[model samples]
Target chain A: MSIPARTTEVIGILGGMGPAATADFYAKLVSITPGASDQDHLRTVIWSDPTIPDRTEALLGKGPDPTPWLLDGGRVLREAGATVIAIPCNTAHAFVPRIADHVGLPIVHMIGEVARYLTSLSPRIHTVGLLATAGTVRAGLYQEWLGRSGIHLVLPDNASQDHEVMTAIRKVKAGTRDDTTTALLTRAARRLTARGAQAVIAGCTEIPLGLSADAVDVPLVDPALILARALVSRAGADRTAR
Target chain B: MSIPARTTEVIGILGGMGPAATADFYAKLVSITPGASDQDHLRTVIWSDPTIPDRTEALLGKGPDPTPWLLDGGRVLREAGATVIAIPCNTAHAFVPRIADHVGLPIVHMIGEVARYLTSLSPRIHTVGLLATAGTVRAGLYQEWLGRSGIHLVLPDNASQDHEVMTAIRKVKAGTRDDTTTALLTRAARRLTARGAQAVIAGCTEIPLGLSADAVDVPLVDPALILARALVSRAGADRTAR
Candidate 1:
C-alpha cells in the first residue's frame, strides 16, 4: 500500500528438525512477546523444512550431515528479509557453527542463551541435569556451554540414554504425549536428581512437550523457552536501537 | 548435501493478521498431519507480518486498504519458494480477491473449505451460525460461500455482534484467553442455536483460542482447523500427482 517503513527486526526461524517442536517454539515466542495486540508483536518468518535430515543421526556418524540443509535454510531466510535467525532445535545447534558463517545473518544461539540464563538465576544453580537426544549429549553442547559458567552438568546413563531419553523423544516426534512419555522423562529426571542435580534442563525441544516442571523435584529449565525469551528481548533491543 | 528429493508441495502461510492466530493455525496443521515423524510433515513458509494494517478497518471503510500489504506478503512467500498460500485470518479473506491474482500462488480458500466441510458432515447441516470479525461478516464471506450449498447462515444481531463477538475477538488478539472471553463467545453461540442453527462456525481464527466445541450445544466448527486439513490433503494430492 503505502511506502513501507523499515521493520526494526524480522525474526527468522530455521526450524522443523521436528515440526511439532518448531510450532511450539513459535507459539512460545508469540506468547512471551510483551504485546497486547497483533500489531504489537514481532515480524516472524518460519521456514519449516521437515525434510532436513535427522541431526542426531548425523552427529552419531550413522547418517548424512545436516550442515548443507541448515545452510540452505539459512539462505532461504536471509533472502526472505530476515534480519536475525533463531534455530529452535537443540541437537541442531551442533551444526550451527558449520553453517553460521554462510547464513549471512546472525543466529541467536539457543544453548548459549541458556547458559547466560542460568548464570542470571536469582538462586545460583550448580549441578543441572539434562534430558536430551543422544546427538546433543554426544556433541557436548550443554557441557561446553554450561562448563564455561562453572555449572556442573549431569546426564543420563548409557542405558537410560538409549531407552528412556531417546525413546521419549521418539514418542514425542510420533505425536504422542501420554503419561508413559511423562513417566519415561520423569524416571530419567529422578535419576539425575538423585545424583544431586538442583535443576533439570529439557535440553531437547521435545523433552518439554511430555514433561513439566512439577513432575521433577528440581525446577525444569526449558532451553526452548529460554530461546523464545532471548528472541523477544533481541526483537525489543533491535526496535530501540533502530 | 544430497539433492532435496523434489518437494511434493510447499505450503505458504500468508498470515500475521494477528501473531497468535497464525501460530495456532500452524500448530493445528502439525497436529492433524498423519505423519509420525518430522519428515512426514509438509514443507511450510510462514510470513507473519503483524504490521499488516487492520483488515476489519479496511472493510469498514475507516482504515487504509490492506491489499498492498497482502500482496507484499504473498510476494515474500512466493520468493521464498512457496507453491500455495494459506491465510489464517478470516477477515483477511475479504481482500483475497484484490491480491489473489497478483500473489502468483494458489491461495487455498479457507471459507470455501469450511463450507465444503460442513456439507460433508454425516448428519448434514442445514443451518449454521457464524462467529467472526465484523469485517468477515460485512464482507459476507460465509454468507456467499455457504449460500451456494443451499445452507442457511444465521448471524449475531448488531448488538450481540458488537458487544459479544467483536469484543471476544479483540480480547484474544490482546493475548487474553480467559473465562470471560469464553463467556462472551458462549453467549453469542447460545443465541444462534436458539434461532435453529445446527452448528456454529468459529469462523475467526482467534475464536478457537477462547471457545472450544463443547462450550456450545452445537458443534463449534473451526475454519482454521478445517483449513489445516485441507492444506494437508492438498499436500498429499500433490505428492501423488508428482
Candidate 2:
C-alpha cells in the first residue's frame, strides 16, 4: 500500500454493534495502513456505543429503535474531523442510509464493497451465498446493493434462513458463541453453496469468529475485510497490498 | 461472587485504548457475570476513542493532550446513564482521576482493582512486577494506588522496562504477533517472576495477548481480567448456581 503524502483524511468509525467488532475494525484499519510510527497512520474518531438497542431485535420490534444513538454517533464523527465514515456492524447498516442522510458524511458502504469484490474476483461468478441477519435480509440491504453492482445474490433457503443466519447473529450480539452456532451456520453455508453460490460472504463480522476461511470448501469472503480495505484506501493507504 | 437483591449498577466504559482491550473487557464482563441472558447481565456503555492522544507522548509534550477526549466521554456516559465509569486502557488511568472528578459518577479504578487483587492473592506479595506504559509508570499510577492497597510494587529494571513492554504494545496495536515480540515478553516475564513477584500482572492490556498464562510459568493476572471480574461483581448477576 502506497502512502499518500504520509497521511490521509481522518476516518470515523460508527461502531457499537458490539465492542469486539469495533476493535477488530480499528486493528484492521491500522494493520493495512502504512506507518513508520503510530502517529503516521490516519487519525480515527470512534463512537462505540454498545448500548444501542439491538438492530435485529428492534427491526423485529423486540426492543426500542437504535436510530437515535446511530444518528448521534454520525454527527459526533462529523464534528470530530471524520471526513469519511465506516460502520463495522452489518446489521447497523439498516440505519446507515438514514444516519448518512442526516449526518452528512461519505459512509463507505460495506455491502457495496462486498459486491465490488465479488465482481472483481471472478468474471464467471454469478451468485453468492450471503449469511447475515434477518433484518439485513428482510431489509434487502445486500440484495438491493448487489443488484446495482450487477451480481446475483443467493440467500439461505427460507426454511433455515432465519433460524440459522439470524440466530447466529443474535447469538453473537448476546455474547454467545458455541458449537450450536457453528452447526447452524455451516448448514446454511452448505445450503447456499449447493443452491448456486460460487462463493459465500460471511456478511456479519461476528460470523467469522465461528466460521473461518477453511470451514467451508467454497470461497468465503469477509465483508469486514472489504470495508477495512476500503477504509485503508480512503485513508490514502495503498489498496494493492490488500 | 454473591448477588444482592437489587441489580448491579451499569458501567460506562471510556475505551479505545486501541480496540482489543475493549472487546476483551466486554467478553470478560459476560464471562464473569452470572447472567443467563442479556438483561440478566448489568447494562454497559462503552465509548472507545483511540484517537485520543498517546498518553506517554502527550504528557511529555511530544503530542497533543488527550484529556479533552477523556472528559468528553466521561460527560457522555454521565448523561447517557452510566452509573459508574471505568477505562480499560492502563495508560489512560493517568488522566482518569482528573476525568473522574468532572464526570459526577463513581469511576471504578482499574489500578485500585489491580492493587486489591495483588493484596488478596498474596499478602506477602512485595517487589511485584508490573508491565504498563512508560507514562503509567512515570505517573506512578500503580505505585501510588498500590501503596493505599498495602502492597510493594517493583517495576521492570529500567532498561528492559521501557522498550520491551512499549514495543510489545505497539506490535499488538499494529496487529503483529511475530516471534520477536513473543520472545521479548516471555523473557521479560521470566525476569519479573525471578525478581520475587508472587505473580506478574500484565498491567498493559496489550501485553497479555502476547504473553499468555502458560508462557511465563507464573500466575499471570491480567488487568482486563480483573476489570471484568469487578464488572461482573458490580453487575450484580445471580450467583445462586455458583
Candidate 3:
C-alpha cells in the first residue's frame, strides 16, 4: 500500500441507485471513521443521480441498461478529483464490470469485500442467507463471490421473494418502515434460517433500513455497513502509505 | 420559474465543515423529498472536503483562511454538472459570498432561507434565538439575514457561547451526542428563551443533531432542515419550470 506522500485518497461515491441507501452509506462511513475532528475523516465526492435506470429492472431485461449512467457518474467523480469509487447499491454491482475499467478510477468491489468479510469472521460463517432483489439473484452476484470464499447462500423461494421480500423493499424505498414491512423481512429471514442458514445478509441496501440485526434469530449482516468500513480502512491505509 | 423543457436542475452540496453534518443534511433531504422511488428523487453531487480549515478559527484569526478551499469545492461541484449549489455548513456561509460568483453556479443561501422560513411562520416570530459556532456569530451570517426580515436575534453571552454552545457543537462533531451535550444546548436555549426569544434556531448544523425540537419549550428551528426543504422546493420549481 506504499505510495507517494502527495497521494491523498479521496473516496468517490457513485450512488443513487436509490438515494436513501447512498445517504445511509455515507452516514455509516462518517460514523465509523476513527476521528476526533473533521480533518480526521476522509475527503469524499458523491454523485447521486436517482434517474439512473433501475439496476434490477435492467438485469431482468425489463428496463434499459444503466451502464452509460454509471459510467457518466464515474467520470463525474474522477473529473471532480476522486481517487477511488464506491457504489453503495448491491444490485448495481451486476453492471460494475462493464464500467469499472472505463471509469479509470479503481472501483471497490463491494461484493468481493463482503465475501472477504464473511470469511474473516471468527468461527467463520459457513452458510449465509441472502435477501436481495431478484435481479441480484439472477445475476448470481452473491453466489459467484461467496462461492469463491466457500460460503453457501440460502435464498427465498420465488413466491416468498415476490410477496414478502420485494414488497418489503419497495415499501422501504417509498418511505414506509412500519411493522408490516419489518414483519415481511423478518418472515423471509425466518424461512431462510429454517433452511439451515447460519446468518443472513441484508443483501439489498434498502433491507438494512427495515430489518434490524436483532429482528431475526441469526445475525443479520449489512453489506453497506461493511462496505463503508472497508472504504474507511482503505482510505486510512492509503493516507499513511509512503 | 419558466424554462425550456430540456433544462434540468442538479444540486451541488458544498459540505464537510464536519462530515457528519453534511451526511445529516443529505439524509434529511432524502427523507423529506416527495418520492415513490429512486427516479422521483433529485440529482445531487456532493463535494465534502473535511480538510477545509475550521471556519470559526479563521473568523477568529486563529487559523488559515478557508476561502480558497471553499472556492475549490465550488469549482469541483460546478464542473461535476451541478446547476445550483447548496452549502450545508452554516459557518461556511461566511465565505459563500467570496466564492458564489466565481463558482459559475447559483449558491442557495441557507441563512436567508431560514429567515424567510421564520417570517413565513403563522405566529410571525419577532425574536429568535441562535445557537451557532463563534465564527458564524462573529461573521453575522444570521444577524444580517434575519435583521432584513425584521426578525430580532438573541445571542448567547461570551460565557455561554464558549462553555455551553460551542462545547456542545464540538462534542457532537467528535461523535459524542450524550446527555451532557444535550443538557449544554438545552441550558443555552433556556437562557435565550428567558430573554423573551420566541423560537430558537439550531443555527449551527451540529445543534440539531444534539438538541431535538422537544428539548426546548420554544419551537426549535433547524436551519439544515430548512435548507433541505429550500433545495427541494427550488429543485422541484426548476424541474417543472417549462
lDDT of 3 by residue, A1-242 (tens): 22112229899999987899999999999988776788777889999988888888999999989888898899999999899999999999999889978999998889999999899889878999999998899999999999998999999999999999999989888877799999999999999999999999999999999989888999888999888888877876323322
After superposition, candidate 2 runs with Cα above 4 Å error: A1-12, A18-20, A41-45, A48-54, A57-69, A72-84, A237-240, B1-13, B16-53, B57-84, B97-106, B122-127, B231-242
Local accuracy of candidate 2 as per-residue lDDT tens digits, B58-148: 7666877788878876776666556888788888888876676688998778888988878776346666778887888888888898888
Q: What is the lDDT of residue B228 in candidate 2?
A: 75
* Candidate 1 lDDT for residue B181: 97
Ordering by DockQ: 1, 3, 2
Off by over 4 Å in 1: A1-7, A237-242, B237-242
Candidate 2 versus the native: TM-score? 0.82
> What DockQ values do the models have?
0.75, 0.19, 0.59
DockQ result, candidate 3? 0.59
Q: Write the per-residue lDDT of candidate 1 for residues A112-150, one digit (tens) a residue.
A: 999999999979999999999999999999999999999
**Higher-TM-score candidate of 1 and 3:** 1
Q: Return the candidate ranking by TM-score, descending.
A: 1, 3, 2
